[model samples]
Target: MSKAVIEFTDFSFTYRAQQEPTLRGINLSIREGEKVLIVGPSGSGKSTLAHCINGLIPFYYPGETAGSLRIMGQEQQEQSIAALSQTVGTVLQDPDGQFVGLTVGEDIAFVLENAAVPLQEMKERVTAAARAAGIGDLLSASPQELSGGQKQKTMLAGVLAGNVDILLFDEPLASLDPFTGTRTIEHIDRLQRETGKTVIIIEHRLEEVLHRPVDRIIIMNDGVIACDLPPAELLSSGLLAGTGLREPLYLTALRYAGVAVTPDLQPQHPELIRLEGAAQRLEQWVDGYREQSGPAEAVPLLELKEVTFGYERETAVLDKLSLTVNRGEMLAIAGRNGAGKSTVSKLICGFYKPSSGSIWLNGRDIGRDTIKERAERIGFVMQNPNHMLSKTLLYDEVAFGLKLRDVPEELIRERVHGVLRICGLHAFREWPISALSYGQKKRVTIASILVLEPEIIILDEPTAGQDYRHYNEMMEFLRGLSSRGITVIMITHDMHLMLEYAQRAIVLADGKKAGDDRPERILTDRSIVEKANLRETSLYTLALRAGLQQPEELVRTFIAFDREVRRR
Candidate 1:
């Protein structure tokens, strides 16, 4: 008795300039009130399919299409974009880009104003929506002044005010920390359940989106629907890896321990996935596992002494924080949102001068150094790839840094080409930057910095919106940099990245150094993990559930096993 909210019949679309169809014969139906998660590798047409439903493909992108696409049982070609907006509400990846008003309440009201709604009713709707999204108190706050999570809530309130029955979230968790992401997903799930709305979430973080109960999981690959089934069936099909999507960490751990996962196993909920004989098998495996890391040989590459800074003098984002980065170290700055992780990177890059602190670069004070001078030694890649891309062509974008440094044309070309190959962007050398996807644009930014050959590289959420293939390529490239004596620091909220890539993790809580040690040691300390709002990996949870003698060994073993498996 489920009503079909969206229906696609032999739907295929190709851009005006391209010959290949982005979506090839997509025949899918999403029922009303169904919660679905759509996932795929980058360039796999997930986003394209989302655009089609929201009326962005034909209206905004100007694509050549064939076959029938319907929203609310109405053919897409018959309805205008503005008309379709009433039925479909989209919360985009970048909340800032969607904002049109100065204050949170005003932003929520702006959409209502466009629809010619009365002033009194608009006010009532905005308040109700804000309260629903749990941002009622932030109504008076400026949209620009709100935190990332708050901004997203503001957008959600705006969407809810539209009173749309079909909600589409595009990478909602990409820019959020673990705690905020979890809460946001839960809130969205509640909205869906309470309203009987059709919700379709397009995200790369499969496991995080699985926090809520998903009715179905749709896997896409190369413009085709690879698999569409219930969550348990999709996880048990063993088709995720082949489709270039990441399986849950707990499932990976179980497989590593030689446990056969059945449909009865809840892969998404690690704590709930109890196999009859799996605990004994995992315990035995952990008992035989040993740590491979040795004691750190300290050699300071960069040092921060008593740093203190804040946008407002009343509150310090970073207060008297001291840290050291050793040579050839791959370190992670781990903390909750607003815990000064990005602030630390900015201070190190000389973007902001510390109010009271000294930054030493190779035994020399860098406090007085200009940003340009600091840039010669330290390279920083921003979290948003669009902010970093300036040139139209991929080659030009990658060679921009070298050009700025007055590197000879010949050398710039050679270095750009070399870095492009390393970052997996060589094939797109002549392509327009606008034509490339978000993941490809991120690689261009990294290549642009890598060509500079800096002694230290700092990346702010480098893999935020990337798929498994691009994420692995970028991480593997960064790993290679660490092996060549470069000091690399990653400011991230991704627990998987912290546990797997970061050799050492520096935990920050309330602008103070909480823990600085091996990632395993830092993560295993439940106090520090909670203080920083970091998620405990399923591997750790599995170890505890199985009553393993050394839970730390499970962490070590999972890291080793994951790396080896990725190597293949």
Candidate 2:
């Protein structure tokens, strides 16, 4: 029998500023050596539950709490956060915020130093943790200079150095690419097995987290536990889609092809999931598939001609790259980390100047234009929403740009409210920015940029950590913008978003143009997908398993089917 590591009994919590409770009557228990996933839509109290476990509810956020809660067989209320830290080590969404030392080795040893360990013991613990995380070579490197995956490993090393038995990961894969995300999950799984730690992962990306086997999935909605079941049972129940959360893409594809999920199937590892008559159903679907008409002739809105740029003189981030964004088109720029995806956006926004080539907006060259001047025509929404938001209130932030342009007061109100409604921030217009969640703050940033009415919008992973509902709403809003003649260029690592919404996609590999074509073509090409480190959608795999000659064609049919389902 396993020992219970966390227990909650009829617990409820409410913020001081709000009238309604965020979490109510929650009862849960997690045992040692168990790996569990917690998923929910936005504003679903998932974070609130995590906060309660980490002692952030009453201590940091100052919320009203009731009922019994225990961690490691001790009453939560009786333990201080400092005391809880010894048992529960949390890896936050942003690893940069958790670092305390300049170098990787120093950061991992910082926890040991606080415990008054001897110098030799501290070094020993740091070395062991770094080796366990497979980041021993990065010990001398600066933490801030590491890549997203390396930074995450460093954070994990710090937690391991503390000798914690309970590990909590809060959206650990949100900032990583698909390849890196897969490796990170593997590392976490290895640590859990070797140390027998209770692993709880709070994430919106359910598929990636399930790369390893999870004992259970706990679905929360409206402050209540909606479903708690083992992975196989949960997938078979079909409750994931009903809860407004995304079911795994492979499972979704199987359902669309008329294949039922089996009781013993694993959704995360698609190769292992087997359904009776799956091949026949997929073959039939492909036989009846019809391709939609291609996109109409596009008029160029933004043009890059032989662009070459590099931070240093000898190294070029983007070398002799040429591309075009058509008016009213949605283009996705995709690649692994350091593939010049964001560099392309930076050049368009005037953050970096191209060394050899020129950039043109409409017909005029804008290579030498200032960022402020380019801001009028091109709006860039960064990955971190907090970096873009300046105003205290949501409404003020959305309206600030128009006010600066000296627009009429009446027109400003009209534009601000309109953009807020489109971005789904109209309801939170009066709320303070600090009171809003990270996802809500991201919407505010998009609204702030949208109210400027720029001809071209460049969003850097706009849906990076967003829930399904928010992602759908935001993508629909961007689609609406494209219909109204606004060019939208999305720099993202999300394969689903790229395949579904982007009519045209540009694949970047080693700072060069790898493939520029329809998203379907770019993803189906083995060389381009592998070189760019992008994952092919499960639809393609299902096509191959169904023995179809043209897998890409069948994949396009799945995309069409999904688009039609959303329309309904």
Candidate 3:
């Protein structure tokens, strides 16, 4: 038997701010050299459990934690998160949140420096860690300049530099592009192969790690271990439904469709349910499309003409890319990290002047106006709310743009308050911006831009750090704006969002257009999904893999079939 690296015995914890304990009745043992994936919905005590592993529960969080958590055979309370660092290295959900150094090289060195390694040996360790994390080429670059994936890998490299016995990652892929996120997990898999260190990852997207060999799958709910089993038996036990976690999308789709799992079938081994329920549900959703005769408006609101953009040497992030956006169109740009997807958004918003090509907004050359003019015409909400936030209070922050435009107090009040309600921030109107959680703050930043009431609104990664319920609310709100005749262009890594919300998807690869098609078309295209490193919706994957080759048609069928099932 392998040695137990960490163990929790009947542990439960309550955060300082909450009346109820976030986690309750948790019991588990982790083995050295083992890789385990922990999953649960948001606020399910998964994070709390992870914090306990490294003693963050009491040290960083002044909370009441009952029961016992042991790290390296020492009680968790005895070891500070700092002291526990030698035994276990932890990376947070956000890479930027954990970054300690301004430059990549300096960050890696800092981890080793704390280990009190010799300067010569430290350099060797840093180099090896950086190489292992695949950030060697970016050693000298500013940490801020690296893409989301690169930033994460840099942090991973820092974690590995200490050469700890156990590594803990908290939703490491939360902020990364799907492609980069998958690659990051793959890199971690490689590290496990080479170093033989125990790894515990807290992840939301199960599909990314599903194919990777893991020692155990631990599901958490209401702060306790709901199920602990090998992958083969995990699903058949009805554990997923009880926990309310989305199973592998494909599996969920199949289960909903009423397909039976055979005795010989292995749940963990890429098994697909036969397409009975799937085809029914899929066809229903597809048939709804026929109900829509045309776009909400008649004329194109934004048009791109042979857009070619890049640095010297004729490099094109947007290679002769041409696209049309009608009033009320919500167009999502998607591709692998570092693909020219964001470049096209920057070009449209006037963040970058295209090397060649012209952009027309409302039948006028957008090139004719300055960025400020472009801002007035189109509002850009960046991925990070902190990046866009400027004011102390939530109300002021939302009103800043309108006030700058010299709008009157009466108008601003009506606009700002209305935005606050829609964005779900009216209650916190007087609170400091710093007081808001990450998701609320993001919505606030978006509300600020929305108040500007630009004809065109562009949001990058709008759904990051959001729950499914909030995701629905935000999209429903965006759909309302589209109904009011605003053009929305989104740059996103969320395939589900692209699948359900977006009317059109523009894919980029190597600084050029890969495909410009309806999202349903793009979502199921095996080549595009592979090349773009897109997360195929479980629904679509199950339908296709289950002998229902046509996903769009299946989606249509499923909607109708689901309603019928509900009705019966």
Candidate 4:
């Protein structure tokens, strides 16, 4: 057996700013060359454990510590971050924030250059690492010009160039499209096998990470280790759901069908899981299930006619695209990165005017409307909360929009508090923005928009950093808003979110409308799914594996059933 590369004994940590320890008594060990996944709900100490391993706890965070943490058999506190980087290479959650060079090659070489490696050696290492990361062709490309997947590869290459023994990825799939996320997992698995390195991933996307094999999964909750077991064992434990984390969708389907999920059945991977009576059980479930009716005929509320837009004149980000959003409709815009998903929201919010198209809002051309004028009817919650957040306190942030519109102070307080409570932020209303976690900040941004109560709300990647419990709460709130005649438009990469909440899905590929239909139809169609860089939901796969005649209908039925269960 390989020796332990990382070990913690009675470990605990408390940030200097906090009275309580973020992590408590974490006694764990990760062997050399092990591939481990750490997952939990938000504020579950998963990030704190990761920071401890990567030397961020003491070196950067300045936390009070207890007990021992050893990386590569060396005491963690004795080593500086620079020294730790030589053994543990960390790829942060946001790749854009990590970029320090103009081109991919230069960025990858930055680490080696910092260590004062020879120029020729640095160049060779950078090229080799880029090739290994499958981004050799993107060496000359600027980080801004690459797709999300490509940018992730660039970040991987930068870490690879460091030649570290352990690679730590922090929420690597958070911003990626479904297809890209699957590919990234494949790459990580391949890198681990080829390099014989220890791989540690901190992520909430458990099912996505389980796309490839992992040796074990470590579940953290409330500042301590909750469960540690192999993937198959963990899946069979029925602990994930109880801990407020989502189990794999296929497993959920299996349980719904009354199938016993056991470790012996190999339940970790959807394709390989053994299901003895799944076909019959699922068939009976489908027979008993009633499908929900489609949305009522939509009265067009917004329209884009031959919208052609580009940052530069020569290349259009959105090319001659056209679509309509119905009033009070819950619409989802989905595509791979760089397919102009966010750009569409920006255009509607009047951030950028279409180069040659008319934007019609309620039968009137709003191309001449200023951004402030658009804000009266349109509320946009951006993907990055940092970009939209300006207030220091949560309450102040949520109330900022209402204050600007000269709403009465008392009414603003009432509205802001209500929205904050709806968004699960009422408890943290007095907290500073910097003190909150990323997921909390996301809610703050959403609350800021919700307080305005605009006619139409546009949320970009609304649930990216959120856990399952909070995601459900937020989506339920949005569903209530939709029921009350507020139009909701979501630009998201979460396949589950798209299937569950979106009434209609608009798929764009190469900046063109590839498909427009119900979410289940868009997801079940192989061509559209691939073209839009999406994965068919595991529920769809489960249906096919169960030998169902109409897999698409099964997908739809499952979603309806799931929604009903959540509603209850």
By lDDT, the best candidate is 4
Per-prediction tally of clashes: 0, 0, 24, 0
Candidate 2: residue 241 lDDT (0-100): 81
Tens digits of lDDT, candidate 1, 1-568: 9989899999999998788999999999999999999999988999999999999989999989999998998999899999899899999988988999988998999879999999999999999999999999999999988877898899889989999989999999878888888889999999998989999999999988888889999999999999998988888888899987888888888888899987887766776786679989888777776655564587899999999999889999999999999998999998888899999999999999998989998999988899999998899999899999888889998888888879999999999988888787888899999988777788888889989989999999988878887788878988888888898999998888898889899999999999999888888889998898887777788888888888878988888767766778
Score candidate 1 by lDDT. 0.89
* Candidate 1 residue runs with Cα over 4 Å from true position: 291-296
Look at candidate 3 and tell me the lDDT of residue 387: 88
Each model's C-alpha lDDT? 0.89, 0.88, 0.77, 0.92
Candidate 1 residue pairs in clash (backbone atoms < 3 Å): none
Give me candidate 1's TM-score against the actual structure. Answer: 0.97
**Tens-digit per-residue lDDT, 1-568, candidate 4:** 8999999999999999889999999999999999999999988999888888898879888979999999999999999999999999988778898999999999999999999999989989999999999999889999988888898899999999999999999999988999999999999999999989999999989999999999999999999999999999999998998899999888887887788899999998879987676789988888898866656778999999999999998999999999999988899999998899999999999999999988999999999999999999999999988899998988998888888889999999899888888888888889889988778899999989988889999999998899998898899999899888899999999998999999999999998999999999999999999898999999898888889999888888878889888888
Q: What TM-score against the true fold does each predicted structure earn?
A: 0.97, 0.97, 0.82, 0.98
Candidate 3 matches the true fold with a TM-score of: 0.82
Q: Report how far off residue 378 is in candidate 2 (Å).
A: 0.6
Model 2, residue pairs in steric clash: none
